[model samples]
Target: MSEAVEPSEWQPDWLSELVNRSTRSAILSTPFTSDQTEGHLPAPSEQQNDPISSGNSANASQPPLADSESTHIFDYREETRLPVTPSGERSVRRTLKGIHLFVRIEILYHNAPRSSNQMITVNATLGTGLYWRGGQILELGGPLAVLVSFLVVGLLSWAVMQCITEMLCIWPIPGALSVYVSQFVDEELGITVGITYWFTYSMSFSTLVATSAAEFNFWRGINDSRTIQGVVIYFLIPLILVLLNTMRIQIYGWLEVATGSLKIFFLIFIIIALIAINLGAGSKESLHYGAENWGSPTDFDRDAADNWVISLLMSISIATFAYVGVEVVSSSVLEAKSPNLSKGGGNPFKFSAIYIPVFATVAYCLSGVLGTLDIAWNHPHLPRLSWLPPDLNKDDKSPSRAAFVVIALASNIPGLDDTFNAFLVFTCLSCAATNLYVASRTLFGLTSRLEGGEGRRWYLRVLASFGKTDGRQVPLRAMIFSAVAFWWFVEVLSEMASVSVLHVWACECLAFIRFYRCIYQHREYLERENIALVQRWSVKNYSDYPYRSYGQPLLAYLALSGCIFVLLVANGAALWNGFHLLPFLASYLTVIVFIGIWILLKIFRSAPWSFVDLSQPKRVAEIFRHLHDIRLGGTDSTEDISEG
Candidate 1:
């Protein structure tokens, strides 16, 4: 079961036809640089370097020479690109000098796709998702269930991250979930996964913006016009993000560093402030954390979670949402700096990825403990601020603030509270910007994949073209498109955001499982070639992979099981207690849409559901380039571990 049976000629007939197709050139298209995910057959000149052919024309199993067309290959070791100077622009050297010192690093933007630091921070920020986690405290009747949710989410995020890291190292391509799944499984399945991923992040533009605006409004006086201010804030922030992103990735990276620092600082501040407040270090009402008048009573009679196992499942759903963007790191492989090199030799994401998740776990853990305590809505004090709205009332409404209760705690610090609260506003802005950037990149990758093939949708071609940079170093069209989608969702499909995000997380786990199976079959093919089991110099064998996943197949299985459970119960909010149709659809809409796309593609492409043969490895075997370093001038990197 560990390896699939070998196929005839060690390649499927269908693969040859696919390699000859024009669409093959479109493979592995990237958002930052122009990499797309397509399959192709190499030319005769190229085959001379292919290990299987031994640089000779007499090899029996080599593919036919590809057409005389130019193709770009992404070298995991490094990236190289010509300056994207606009037509009739100044000389490249002159252009560099004219650009600001900060933006001059634009050369590296295309040369080295992702730096380790950027990857780590981006991963952590995605995981932190600063404001989204707070939406649950109000109706989570099961305090115990919420408490367990923190641990469950942490483990699940680890599993998913491992799956992505392993696959990206082996395949080393963009479109992340899309690229890996398509190469390992059915192309349609890959598209389904990619589109879902695209939708999840793209929709966040409006969702994150709207959420940030709401959080910002919480601090304003009741006399302020909340509606007008919210609309203005929502529109204003996205504009800043879009402008910043359209410039260059370095600009984007700097922003991430700045915001990421702020995000981490604010996150720590919240945690510490909460602990201090609980200790009664500073408070107007003298309320004790979780004390009778200060905290909530842990009452099972008051919770559906206490009586029903299903209620705990609901709590798990909430936890899963909290961990949505952690996988953003996977997409960075194409542009990540020195992906082939380790940190110190390279960059920060490696360090940040580990701690960010830990911080998230602590935050969630503290949140669960704090949720059952004196949440803002149930706070025993604040009568002096009677002018505040009922929802913001210092007395009954204080407990609903849950993790945000730190703001009130800061109030006790006099000189420090308002400044800390202003930082919170900056934190929200940072979160919105980060989510928006991820969302745009994801859509760009997805649409690029769609641009290939004879019957490819016309609109997809236009969109794919839109994602391409016009020498500006960013995907402007894609960013604008994503922004529009976000605003539309915020205004119209607002309710669908929660369910859609949950569905995407579950799909991430499933895609990894598919890739795991694909690699096993790929190994069986190389076994017949008598290649070394773990040759980093060659990609013909499974162990030849630079970074082998830890506890995979097993971790994948464990994660897959957990994800399935979450996916099934994700709709519990509507169905468990009452079976409301809209809520059910909101939860399961992504699944329904995906299934429909799967069937439609199967019919059109004449590919059956069983096209992916688990027992025998096929189509995908052609994908692993045995040449290893054909573009690097006949050699692989000395560094074996590409990502941690």
Candidate 2:
């Protein structure tokens, strides 16, 4: 049981606002049980602090909280704790899980919703984009690439985290990030960000499929399986993942903890192994085969460039997926316990502060050293087809004919080959499992939105009844539905790997560009608009990062600026380079169409047209005349000034 509160002599202007937001968020987060209802009311100390308390105490009156007065808030201290169960009662723990709702919210709200969600086990499964074909690159990039990517991703992730943390730390809502991002950003930015998030989720599922396929391919070669056998084995991995996900959340958490431990173990072990092998070889060496490998006119050189770049990109793509789940913490900010005292929400700064450079460094040391060792011995040759440590390329019967280039040159040592093989196997399995969990959860979040509001409503209603309301809530229906979606989506992506990497690269690049533009253009409103939402929810001192450390907001300004230039070139190259240009054109056009659809949706949803429109409500009416086609039927065509 918790201690009884005493009235504080000092009061801040934010106190009433904080209490009101906390109470409201508790009410909205989930259904509460009779015992859990205390969270929805004022603390006993707060009740004593009330001006009316003096009169009541003088009259020797019983507390008004015991009466059925039904004011804006009440006290529920006596109702919070349930009696402890007997030692033999196993079922009691299961029942007690539901009671944790109020307690979790209190901790989250006070601590700032971001930390709780970010530190928990599910975060490892949620934020990493482990679900796509190109999801492994960051996980395997060398130090130079990892360093660059980390700077970019770390800052971006941090910015997003700060925005979310500020908005929901005080109030702590389940859909917290979306709530703030939607409110603070102009409609253009809001809708675009929403669409980007949706696509990221979708692609994450695709990454999972691609990763599983790669791992299965590795395994098939190791075991000397035929193509059909490999396919069967590949298909079965996701099934096990789905079954695991379908169980209760605690079970899922335990599985993640176990799997995560294995992953970290393998990653650490590989790094140590690579360092040992390198040290034994008695020479520090460069990992790159040099700029010469980039490309040349000779057929062999051109082919080498293509293979190396493509393989490197593939690795980077996969690594990017690993980082995707990092943002999953933002979704459950509302259920954090005591958000005001804790007061951190979706601040990716905190989460990614740990995520970006740290993971990137780990990836570089592990994969880079391994690659260096492979290349040192193999001398720029790809891995063997036999799936053995002496071989960089596994003999798997996948459509990917390009071999895994072993960058590690230290393979000359005795017993090293066997150890490397063991390490590779563990890597494949760990990455596969991580991807599956991410894919499952992303699908669930996506499906929850597609189901309209009913799915979320029911999830909240259940919590409400338990008096266990909090922002970090989970909707079981969403998870189940997501698992089903992942099952189908993975299959489709795995079968579609034959398409040229250039085409796929272009599509991904364009999508990234559009997302960057949306957020960049409305950076100010994106931060400012979350205040009301933060206030309403009693999220403490919600505020976004004021400035990005990396130059300007626009992504087009970076050294990677050439990549966007390449996207344009790739568009033309694909059309002219041989295969039918029509398919390429169609796919490229579809990407544009998707962006356009989101823009139109924002218009129809009564979202403000620009950042300027966020301040001038009257201006909204003037612009609506020209933008009447954008209006939708649900919410009013104008901003709800009263609500703000």
RMSD of each candidate relative to the true structure: 10.8, 13.8
Cα error, residue 176 of model 2, in Å, equals 4.6
Clashes within 3 Å, all models in order = 37, 119
Over the stretch 1-644, how does candidate 2's per-residue lDDT look in tens digits? 32332212221111111212332322211212212222233334343332112112232212211111212111112111111110110010111121122111111111222123332222243222221211123222332333344344434333333333333333232233332333333434433443344344434444444443544453446347665445654565545655664554444444444554454555566566555544555223432332222222111212112433433332332333333443444333222222212222223223332343345334533444243332322233332212112323434333321112132323445554445444444444443443344333333322221211133345433322322111222333433334344344532232222122222222223333333354444434433432111122122433322212233234323323433333344233323323443434432543464458656755544543554333343232222211111111101101111122
Q: In candidate 2, where is summed lDDT lowest over 10 consecutive residues?
A: 83-92
**lDDT (tens digit, per residue) of candidate 1 on 1-644:** 12322222423221111111132222111111111111222332443333322222233243421111112111011112111111111000111111111111111111223343232233224332333344253234334555666678778776766666554444333466665565455656766676677677667556666655655555656217866665567666678767876765545565555555545566667667656655665664435335541244333212233343554565566566666656665554333433322111112233223444565667667655654443442333211111122443233444233245343553467644455546556655555565566666666555532322244455444654644544544556767777777575633254455456554555556666865665565554645543321233354443334455567678877877777666666445436555545556656776678789777766655555663454544333334432211112111111111121
State the displacement of the C-alpha of residue 422, model 1, in Å, after optimal TM-score superposition: 3.2
10 residues in a row with least lDDT, candidate 1:
89-98
Q: After superposition, which runs of candidate 2 have C-alpha atoms over 4 Å from their true positions?
A: 1-116, 119-172, 175-177, 186-199, 206-210, 219-235, 281-301, 304-322, 332-338, 342-349, 354-357, 376-476, 486-590, 599-612, 616-644
lDDT of each: 0.46, 0.32
Provide the global lDDT of candidate 1 against the true structure. 0.46
